[model samples]
Target: MTECDDTHGCDTISRRAALTGALAILASATARPALAQTYPTRVMQLIVPFAAGGGVDVVVRVVAEAAGDILKQRLVIENRGGAGTVLGSQAVAKAEPDGYTLLAAPTTMVINPALRSSLPFDWKTDLVPVAMIAKLPFVVTSGLKLPAKTMKELEALGKTRGTPITFGSGGANTVAHLAGEVFGLVSGAPVLHVAYRGEAPALTDSMSGNIDVMFSTLAGASAHVKAGTLRALGVTTAKRTSLLPDVPTVAEQGYAGYDLSAWVALVAPKNTPPAVVATLNAAVNGALAKPEIAARLIEIGAEPAPDTTAALASFMAKDAQTWAGVIKAAGIKGE
Candidate 1:
């Protein structure tokens, strides 16, 4: 064999390696779409970043079956609640961007980063929106004994009693908590915030007249309102819900833009393939559109709001902006 020059051999090998790498990258790029097409070869995990019996968990269980059926695969829900949803969310944010692991995120997903500092993942970028599964607005509720029936009435009563309005919430910096704070800001009232372990206990206190008022979930407050244990002053959404059509919205009550809602969304880790995102979004929307499924969600207080991936992204961005303003004005911090 003829001997090769050292520099020429080195250059030749380097060029060959570079070409091999380029071809490998090209092959990978080519395979992704096909791979996305055949996604969900196995069970998919939808993590509920709250306790098993919480609102997020209930919503996930409601839609998981139909969505799984749509994709021809099983969707498993895993509860990883702790650190105010950080523990479970971090798992999803750092999970492989392969579309298998997803987060059934809630309003807390947008509230946590601003309420807490130095989070392990960047809330703005670490995860991507896949679909908005359900949304339900809060209800301004009071105990049967409270004289106030509207937000303004509560404010005026507080002044007449020579005391600030007492409001209880599930926790500090929660959507309910901040909604009360925002109500105070817009209504020009001195509001006292009492934090409880969860919304259930706070609502229990509200019905007992221990607290003057609470911004509560429509689901949690609906039964009480119907039973005459709690009075629904106003809905916190832009418009009244059909379930409570007779109850007017806070916006219609004179706070023209005072609207807030609690919702659950589906999200995947950053860099999850767009084709995979599209597939999952379709699955979720199909699941929600079913009449039985829609009825179930409505019974639980969340109205099915099947959404496009782009719309979900815009919704989350707007949600974050809205809560950021509330959090800043309230001087709230996380545990």
Candidate 2:
């Protein structure tokens, strides 16, 4: 009688334990979707890795404002510009991966790792791509009297000039700098680089005949090109930018296969929930698809590029590899 009573008690306890385990699993499964649904119950922050009034900053604010409406939460912009975008980037990388903090990452994030051995964060591991917001084409602009209207003429001048041709950029290892180096490598022209505080100053110096040319931003140089102060020799991308439709591409100008452009994307700190990533991606792509949003981006020289997170990841990986090769060949170093 005693043995039978003990077995019955043990079975009853085991059944209760099993019931508890099942309920716990069921709760966990439902909790994640609930968390995603309730995300952004408050304001979120977007870190712009550049200063205010910059192209990236403007582009991010436009889309962020639209996305805020969709999510019913305000997305605030904070500019933490310093150390070649490293300061702002590290701020986001170390932020809590709770989907509230994000980085308005530019192409420089990918190239910086390859250019410098030590960085506060590892882009590959510390940050993850959320969405590809837009891409802007670059242009090769020269002073009106630089003695070269086309890239071929420029190459000949480089050969004949007593000193190597000087190409100025906003800073060392920036997209403009790399594009300038690429031009030299492909054309076999002896080129030297001049780094300035910013593209505006570099373009200023180029206008004064301090530099031979500049692989520059179309947005910043377009007005001068239109004003006849700066002559745009060629567009750097594979296709010509509509903003400067009259200019030919470097490839079309007989430098075939030479194509480059700068891009911007949204990135999040590591370990941010996948559901959060999905939500942000949807918001960003939706914002990009809106007609007004697209128009605004176009007005600023950015091509609206709404894409899946997976596509962004693949594109960035390939771009990083390409930049690594270019930086290595050009012997590019950090600022």
Candidate 3:
């Protein structure tokens, strides 16, 4: 063999490497569509960051069940409630970026980051919003025995009470807790927060007169309000909800812009394929469009709020900002 010059051999190797890389890229581009098209070969896990039987869990189960039918695959619900939603949320954040693992969380997903200085994962960076399922306005409810029957009366009573008026929350830094803090800020009342394990316990305490006030989801407090166990002062929405049509909103009740509600949405670990996100978003919206699913959600005091991925992402960003301001103003701390 003739002696090979160094330049010629190196140039040939580089060209071959470049060609191989080009072919590999082309193959990957071709495979992505196929993978997205044939996704969900296995069951999908929808992790609810709250306990079963709570408002979020109940609503998600209904929507997930419907969406599962539309996607023609099982969407299994796994409740991982603890640490004010941090436990379950962290699980999803650390899970593989594959579409198989999903998070079905409430507003707490956004609120936690604002209230806590240190979190296991950064929600804004690690979790990608897939779809918004529903939103439920909070009903400012009081124990039946409380002297206040209206928001104004509650504020007056809270100001005059020898001890700070106690408000029950599902947990520290939860939406309910933040709502109560907002109410206190707007009304200039001295309020004490009582944290519970979940909404069920908070509602139970409210009904038993153990707590003076609770900003509870319409679903969690409606039955008690209707049964005369809890009194509805005002709803935490800009307008009255159809489920509680007779109740006035906090905005209309002299608190001109007091709108706070709990919302549920689906999110996945960052880097989940865009095609998978699109597939899930389409399935969620399709399920929300079904009259049966809509009716059931409304019956439980939730409004179907299916939206595009970009819209949900923007909404969550704004929501987080709003809550961050509120938390900072109120000096709220996380558990």
Winner by lDDT: 3
Q: TM-scores across all candidates?
A: 0.78, 0.83, 0.87
Error of model 1, residue 110, in angstroms: 2.7
lDDT of each: 0.83, 0.86, 0.87
Number of the top TM-score candidate: 3
Clash pairs for candidate 2: none
The candidate 2 region of ten consecutive residues with least summed lDDT is 49-58
For candidate 1, the lDDT comes to 0.83
Q: For model 3, where is the 10-residue window of minimal lDDT?
A: 1-10
Ranking by TM-score: 3, 2, 1
Error of 2 at 73 (Å): 3.1
Backbone clashes for every candidate come to 0, 0, 0
- State which candidate, 1 or 2, has the greater lDDT: 2
